[model samples]
Target: MTGRVGIIGIGQSNFQPRRNDASYPDLVREAVVIAMRDAGLDFDDIQAVVYSLSPDAMVGIGNAERLGVDAVGGRNKRFLRINTGGATGISSVITAWTHVASGACDVVLTAGADKVGECGDSQTVLNKIWDPIYERSLPLGTINMLAMSAVRYAHKYGMTQEDMARVVAKNRRHASKNPHAHLRKETTIEEVMASRMVSWPVKLFDCCPQSSGGCAMVLASERYIKQRGLEAVWITGLAHSSETYYLGDRMGRGFTADHADAHALGASFRKSFRMSGIKDARKEVHVAELYAPFSNTEFHSIEAAGLADIGTSPAMLREGAFALGTNAGAVVNPSGGVLCTNAIAVTAMVRIAEAALQVWGRAGERQVKGARVGIASGNGGDHQFFGTMVVEA
Candidate 1:
């Protein structure tokens, strides 16, 4: 059970507003085929299956993983479904990693597809997650939840709406170079500022698009990797943490994690970084794939990952740090992040996948030069659930 595991293959389908041509199951198959081919393994080689699907309401189908059971070769193998709101993807990947690391399975398959574009009222469906007994009274959906966080972050720090605009412009520029990204068109700071205000400082351009796509990953034990002589990227460190369910509690202090700063989220990454043998993340980490679906959230998410000091990310970002061609030590979200493409169940999984791709040196034009260490984060449900992972080449 002490076996080491690594990500041997990764695949993602083209993300778009909708995949009208393909059913959700087809999307799963598309990604699975690509991942299997990338790993040079047959479906028979997979000993376990971890299906990553979050919020069946988004897809309007209950237990949707059932539809893709056959596609993932889970008919007779061990199978489990995972959902932790937005963190479902990485959670599922971690589950697969455990299967191999535990010596129960030499190779495990993790696959998921999301069709949030098909949901009639995505926000309403997502809002049901709030506690009707306490928090539901505020009608806090995804945007306004982070919008309030933005207000607090701005108040605590000197971040202006212009800072948020720059974040949008920078991510859009990154997305433009990534074909798998949903919002690929580059935008300017002026353009982002001019966009419609969705939730105060969180402009329409600052938000992630409702995307539909699929992603799959192949993981194997180190023994299996060596036996097969396969190329792989090691999952060096990983962990997940959570905040209190109530948004009000995260307001001031003394709660799970402060809204003004991602201390709890930082705790999660620090645990992973240490486990991965990273003593100083700011200098050791060269690339990061963060799950900041909104522009303003990226600042704290970066700080939480130890990529920058808390409350200093906005200024560092303003100076063109974290951009692709910058001299900064680390580049965050080279795949344009979830702000460019957010397929709910697969979003966090895609973060790790993008990070693995960067470490694998297969990130195409969006690749960070000489990227050796990559970290990814997944945030779910009112910022309650946070997960972090570290990968090394």
Candidate 2:
């Protein structure tokens, strides 16, 4: 693609239950150092830095980025931070891409970090983002909000809870191969069904764990890539959309109008694909790493991204269409997805990094053969915010 930006290097800390060895700033530095090494570039090569974090409440510090700038090589350089709930990670990358694409910088670094376990109750903190006058009064946690959508999906599509469990099982199975995954064990439908229920249909297994980790990536303009003689994946397309903050605004309307300006998936995906000059994403794209914290959300995400027809995702899973080596099928979440590795603040960025790794042929045993095009997505704020990006080798 013309006027394309490429990711030269990507790096992440080993996601674990707790990273006691490093403070938040140290964690960010660890990832940035790895990313620079991966790109074969040093700190002097970076021109700017874009940092991402969910909220100060989670970290017990305000302007967390300020403490992280020096570690990220942002000293005396252009630095910016982004916070958009769960979508912060991907949005941060998009911002960094803009800096390079605009010819304002030769190389830009984007990073996200969190210590979710340090917080007493992240769910309570997340609830504060809801409308207090109407929605927050219900004391609806994030799982319950997603459960409502899962229930609606089941009733409308004539599916059962078992179908959702299958999604969890598949993602967990995929995570087994990811060394950095938070949860690496495989699960069965019976096990999921037996797990403790947090909401009506959501069980402990169906939800993502509160993980502590960080991720960083290095982006370079075409000029930089050529000068360094490095192979790069082009940033083909990027698009973002946000809906009204209130959940009541989308009630009674179909899935299209829920929380964020109706189901903006179709519109957002279309814009990204068109901008990338790629037609027929289902066939052209070789891999997908979507941000789905819950099982049912994964099903709806596949449809929203045009990977399958509406109401057909469950059946596709039944047929093993998303598995690796399936004929005419694209591999989905080979890294076990968010269900297996939920690093909250860095979850969405992990999706982008995973996709880039696949294209770069650096995914090791998890690599997909002949991977050329890839897609990554993130959803935040009660499904009210969306971000999508397209990358090609």
For each candidate, give its TM-score against the true structure. 0.98, 0.96
lDDT of 2 by residue, 1-393 (tens): 226699998988778777888898988888888888888988888889999887778887888888888788888888999887788899899999999988899899998788887888888987877778777777877788888888877777765778889888888877887887888899999999999998888888999887888899999989879987997888889899776565555667553465312266567778899998878878888888988898888888887778888778888888877766667667888888888877777788898999998887777767778888889988877777788898888
lDDT of 1 by residue, 64-123 (tens): 988989878888899999998998999999999989988899999999999999998999
Q: What pairs collide in candidate 1?
A: none
Model 1 error, position 77 (Å)? 0.5
Clashes of 2: 3
| RMSD to the hidden true structure, all candidates | 1.0, 1.9
RMSD of 1: 1.0
Cα-lDDT of candidate 2: 0.83
Model 1 weakest 10-residue run by lDDT: 251-260
Cα lDDT of candidate 1 equals 0.91
Top candidate (TM-score):
1
